[model samples]
Target: MATEELNAIEIEIARNRLSSIAEEVGSALIRTAYSPNIKDRRDCSAGLYAPDGTLISQAEHIPLHLGLMPTMIANAIAEYGAENIREGDVLMTNNPYIGGSHLPDVCVISPLFYDGELIALVATMAHHVDVGGIAPGSMATHATEIFQEGIRIPTMRLFAAGQIQSEVLALLMMNIRTAEKTRGDLIAQVSANRLGLRRIHELVDDWGVDGFHRACDSLLSYSERRTRAAITKLPDGTGTFTDYLEHNGLYAAEIPITATVTVAGDQVTVDLSETADQVDGAVNCSYAVARSCAAYVLKVLADPTLPSNAGLTRPIEVITRPGSLVHAEFPAPVAHGNTQTSQRVVDTIFGAFNEFTEHLVPAASSGSMSIVTIGGIDPKNGTYYSYVETYGGGQGANPDGPGASATHTHMSNTKNTPCEVIEREYPLRVERYEIVRNSGGSGLYRGGEGLRRSLTLTRGKATVVAGTSRVATRPWGLNGGGDGGPARVEARTNGEVRELESMGSLQVGVDGTVTIQTAGGGGYGEPEAGR
Candidate 1:
C-alpha cells in the first residue's frame, strides 16, 4: 500500500506501537543493568530507526542522548556499509569525532532483518562509569586532548554472526578501571537491542513488511508537516544572544557560546559560526552535540509534544564553524562539553529566542548538571569502585507559573542517584541532603530552589572530581525578574575547609567531605510591591 493511502488511524496505531517498543527496551535495559548509574540513575537511552538511518521512535530519555543517537547511527552506517551489516551483527563506537557526545557514552547498534531483508535498526547509548582516562570516571576536567580522556572506539563489530567476539571485548575490558561493571553494562545494552529486534519482528508479522514501511513513511511525513506548521506560527525575525561557560577546567576564564536564530516562513536556522574557537580544555564539543542542542531548543519553542524523530529536525538547520566551541575538531577534549558546555548552548539559544520571538521563553535555570565522580578502592571488598552522579537544580520560571525546584533541566534528563544506593554501592556516606532555601530568585512568580548535597568518605581515600557551572555567572532572569543564585562547591579535610573551583579535582582523605550547592532558577517576572 502507498504511504499516502494509509489513514490517520493506522498511522497513529503504528506510532504508538513503535514508541511502546522503544520505551519497553529502555525499561529492559534499566531493569537488567548491573550498575547503579543505569539501574538507578538511568543514564541510558533507546531508539528505533529506519534502514536508511532515519530515527523512527525514541524513548523519552536524555535529550542529549536522543538528539545525537541518530547522527551516531548514520555515521556508523556510513563507515561500515549497511550492505556489510547482516543479521545478528551489532556495531559499536564512542568516538566523539565520529558522531558521539563523549568518550564515555558508548553506543551499540543492531540491524534487524525480516525475511532476509534489512527492515529496521535498534540502538542504545549509555554512559559507562569508567572508560580508561586520566580521571576515574573518564570525565577528566584538566584533560587537554581526547587521547587523555578514554578509550576511543570506532565503528566495529562487537557481535558478529550471532557470536560474541571475545578478543574484541577483552581489548575494551583491559583499558578501563572497573572491567566487570563495564562488561555488565555493555551486555545490558546488547540485551536491550535484542528485545527491540524481537518486538520489531512481531510488528512486521502483524503488518506485512511493505505495510510497516508505508506506516513509517506516513508517520515521518505527518511529523514533518506538524513541525513546519509550528515553525510558520512564529513571527519571522532574527535574534542573537551569547552565554559563557564559567571555567574551562584548565583556566578560570569564561568561554563564550553564541547562538543566532532566524525564523523565516516554514523553517528556522541556528547559526553558531561566530562562537569562540575550541579551547585546550575539555569544554569543546563535536558538531553532533551542537546540532543536538539546537534541535532540542527549537523543539521546546516550536512544539514540545511533537513526535521525536528525524522528521522533526527537517525544518531546522544548525550551522557551526569548524573548530569552534560548539563544533570542535579532532583531538580537543570534550568530556565536559557533553555536560557543561551543552547547557550553555541551550541557554544561549533560548536567550536569543527571547530577544525577538513572541514565545514566552523562561528565565535561565541553574545552568549546570553538577556532575560528581569519585573513584577508589572499597575498604569492605578491596575492589575498585567508581561512583558517578549528576545533581538536580532549580528550573527556570515560565509565564505559566514558577519553575520547578531541585530538578534536572535542559539537555540532561536523569534522576539523582538515591542516597541509600550510593552508600551501599560505593565507599561513601551521605552527610547532608536538603534544599537550599531562598536560593531562587524572587519575582511575581519565584524561581525554583536549588539543593545542597554533602558526601563523606567512609574508609579509604578517593579522588573526587566536580564539573559544574553558574559559579561566576548567575542564571539571568527574563523581562523584569531577578537573577538566580550561583553554584558553589566546597571540600573539608580534617580541620580545614576550602572552596573548590567549578571544574577541578581533589584528593579527599578519610572522613573528608565534599559538598555541592547547585544554583536556583531565575524568576519569571518583577516582584510585587513590598511593604
Candidate 2:
C-alpha cells in the first residue's frame, strides 16, 4: 500500500483500532493492580508508539503522564541504544531528569515485533504507593533534594528476553515500605504491556505490515493538517499572563510562573523564560513536564477532538530557560511539581490566551490537586500500608453556562478512592465527605463549588502529608466576575485542633483526624444587583 493509496476511511479505522488497544491496556492495568492508588483511583496511563519512539495513540487518561511517557521512552531508547534493543526486552525508568515526571511514576517499555522485524512499541506508567524516601509515599513536602524523594532508577532493563530479572526485582522491593503491593502493581504493568503487544500483532496480521505502516503515516499527516488549519482560525497575536504558587514546599514566599503565547500563521510558541528560578524545595518540574502543560493548553484552545499523536504537537514550540522553575536542573526536588506546578502552568498559559483571544477561554478554576498521603501499620494485619489520593475541586464557568462542582480538572484525570475501599484496605475511616456551599464565586454565571473531606485514624499511628495551593491567592475571574475562595487544611488530635500550611506534614495518633477543603472556580461575568 502506497501513501497515495491510503484513503480517509483506512486512516480513521487505523486510528480507532490503535486507540482501542491503548484503552484496553489501561483497563487491564487498573483491574489487575493491587494498590488502591492504581486499582481504585486509576492513576496510570498506556500508549502505543512507532518504532522510532513517536507517539501514535494513547488512552484518554492522565494528561500529564500521556504527554511525558513518549519523551521517557525515547530517552530510554537513546540511552540503551535502539540496535541493542531485542524482542521481549522491557526497559524501565523513573529518573525525572531523563524525561520522567517523578520517581514514583515508574515507566516500562517493550518492543513489538512481526516477522522478525521491529514494528512498534508498547508502554505503560503506574504510580506506586511507596518508593522509599523521607516519607512513605515518596512525596515529601520538605525535601530539598532529589535523593530524599525516592529510589531513582535510570534507564535499565527490568525484563530481558522474556525473562524477569529476579535480582533487579529484589533490589527494588527491598527499598520500598510496601513491598507486596508494589510488586503486585509492577507485575500488573508488565502484563498490561504484554496485552498491548498481542493486540498490535493482531492488527498487523489483519492489515498486513505494509498496509499498517501506510495507515499510521496517513493518520499522522491528517492530524498535522487539521492542527495547522485550526491555528489559522485564531488571529495572529501574542498574549502574556503571570500567576503565583502559594509556596515552594519549604517557604511561605510566593513563586511566580509566567507564560507568553504567540500565534503565527500556522504555528504557536509558548515561552517561559520569564519564570522564576528553581527553588530549594519540591515545587520544580522537568522540561518534559513543562512541554506537556504547554501542549495540553494548545489542544484545549485549538481543536481538542484532534487525535493526540506526535503530529498534533508538531505545530507547537515550547521555550523554557534552563534551571528555571518550569525547567529544573538535575538534583532539584520535583515530586510535588508533577501535580502541583503542572496545574499552575496550565492556568498561566490559558490566562495568556484569554488576554488577546477575544475572551474565548473560561475563568480560572481551583488551581490545585490537593494531594493527601498517609502511611502506617495496619493493626489488624500488622502489615505496612500507604494510602495516597488527590481530591477534586471546582471547574471554571464559561460564557455558555455555569461550571460543574467537585471534579478533577486539567493535568489530573483520576477518580477518587471509594470510601468502602479506604475502610477495607487501611486503618482509617472517612468520617465526613460533602460539598462546601457558597464556595463558588457569585456572578451572572456562577463558578463551580469545592468540597471538604475528613479522615480519621482507626487504631494505629501514621504520618500524613497534605499538599495544595491557592490558599493565599484567589482564583481569578473573567469579564468583571468575582474571584473564588481559597483552600484550607486542618488537623485535630486529642481534642486539640491546629491549622496546616499549604504544604505541611504531621504525625497523628489513633483517633486523630485530618480535614481538607479544596478551592472553588471563578465566575464568568459580573453579578446582578441583590435579588
Candidate 3:
C-alpha cells in the first residue's frame, strides 16, 4: 500500500525493474547514435531522476557522464525554470559555463508527464564529432577563446510539441562545417530521449507517478547515507597531492595541479585555489568539470560502491579560483581544458586520499588519454571532413589484478573504433594495434600494459593530434612498486622522428606512421603487502 510498507523482497524486485528501465535507455541511445564514440565506444549516459533532480536509477554507462548528470540537471532546470517546461517540448544545450564540459558533448533533456502532471525528465547526452567550432572538429588547441571552441547552444527547444523544430535544426546546419553528420546525430539524440520517455511513462503506469517519485527520493537519500557511513570509517585529517602538465598550447608553461583535501569524518573539502593561474591557451576547465573531477577522486578513493547520486556528492566540496586553469573564464578556449586538467586533478586527489587510506588508492594511472582529430577531404566523397578519436594507454595496477592494456583513463567511457568502422568512416587505416610488452610496472600486482597503434593515411591529407602524459613523467606506482613505461609519439616524415603533445593535432600528406605509446598505471602497496 505504501513505499515503506513493502517488504525487503518487494523492494529488491522493484529496484531490479527500475534497473531494467535504465538499461533500456542505454540500449536505445547506443543504437541511435551516429559516431563510434556512442554507437560502439559507448561514450554516453542515461539515467532516471526524481522531479527534484535526484538519481533514481542509471544504466551502467560511463562513470564520468553518469556522475555529472544530477548536478547538470539541477543547473539545467534553474536555467530554463522547471515550471515553464512543457510536456512535448525538449531542451538542449552545450554551455560549459552552465553545466557541460564542451560543445561537442551536447545534452538533450525532456520532461515526462502522465495525465498532464510532471513525472520525470528523460535525458540523453552524446559527444558529436563536430559542433561547429573554428576547427573542423570542436577540439581546437590553437584557439584561445570559447568562440573558437564550437557551437554553444543555450537551454532551448530542439523539439517542440513533439515535432522537430526546423528553425533550430537550420541554425545548427548553418554553423557547423559538417552539417549532414552533425544533424543526423542531433536527430538520433532526440529519438533516444523520446524512447527513454516512453519507457518512463510505462514505469509510471506500473508504479503510479507519485510512487515512482517517492521511491527515487528514498533511493537517493539511501545512497547519501551509505556514502556518509563509509566516510565516517576513515581518519579525520587533511591530505594533498600535486601533478603537472607538459605545457600550455601558446608558451612553455608547465602547469601545476594541486589538490588539498580535508577529510573531517564523512565530509571532504577539496581546495584547488593554490594551483597555478589560468593560461593564455585552451587548457582551462569549467566549474562543472572541476566539480565532476573532484567527485571522481572520491569515487576512486573513498567509496565507489556508494550509489552515484547527489547524496554521494553531499560529503564532498570542491573550491577553485574562478579564473585559474581549473576554473576558466567565459570565452576562454576550454575544448581540451577539462580532459587535460581533470586527469591530473584526479591524480592529485588520489595522492591526497592515499594518505587517509593507503590500501585503497593506488599509484597514478597511465597519465595520458590522447585524441587524434583528423581533417581533410573525404577521399571517397570529396567532402570536407573532421573526426575526433580517442587513444588508449595502460591502466594502473590494483591489489587483485593487473591493469588492462590500452585503456582510456579517468572520466572516459569510450571504446576504440573497430578497424572495420575506421576504414568505412574515414580515409585512414589503422596499420597496427597491439599491446606493448613489458609496458606495465613491475610489482606483485603489475601495472596494466600500454599500447602502440600505427595510423596510415590513404586520404590526400589528415591531422594527427597527440595528448599524452608519461613522456616527461612515468606513471608512479604505490608502496614499492615500479613505475610504468613512458609515453612517446614518433612521426616519420620521409623517416624523420619528431616530438608530440599529449593534446595537439597534426597534418600529414599521406603514408605517415603516427606511432603512439601510452603510459601504464601505478602498482598498489609493497611488493609483499598482499603476501
Candidate 2 clash pair list? none
Number of backbone collisions per candidate: 0, 0, 7
TM-score of each: 0.98, 0.98, 0.94
Point out where model 1 deviates above 4 Å.
Answer: none
Better model by TM-score: candidate 1 vs candidate 3 = 1
Q: How many backbone clashes does candidate 2 have?
A: 0
Model-by-model lDDT, in order? 0.90, 0.90, 0.75
Candidate 2 yields a Cα-based lDDT of 0.90
Model 3: residues >4 Å from true position, as ranges?
A: 1-11, 525-531
Cα RMSD of predicted structure 1: 1.2
Question: Ranking under lDDT, best-scoring first?
Answer: 1, 2, 3
Candidate No. with top lDDT:
1
Candidate 3 backbone clash number: 7
Clashing pairs in 3: 146-331, 396-521, 463-506, 466-502, 467-502, 467-503, 468-502
Write the residue-wise lDDT of candidate 1 on 201-257 in tens digits. 998999889888888888888899999999998889899999999798897987888
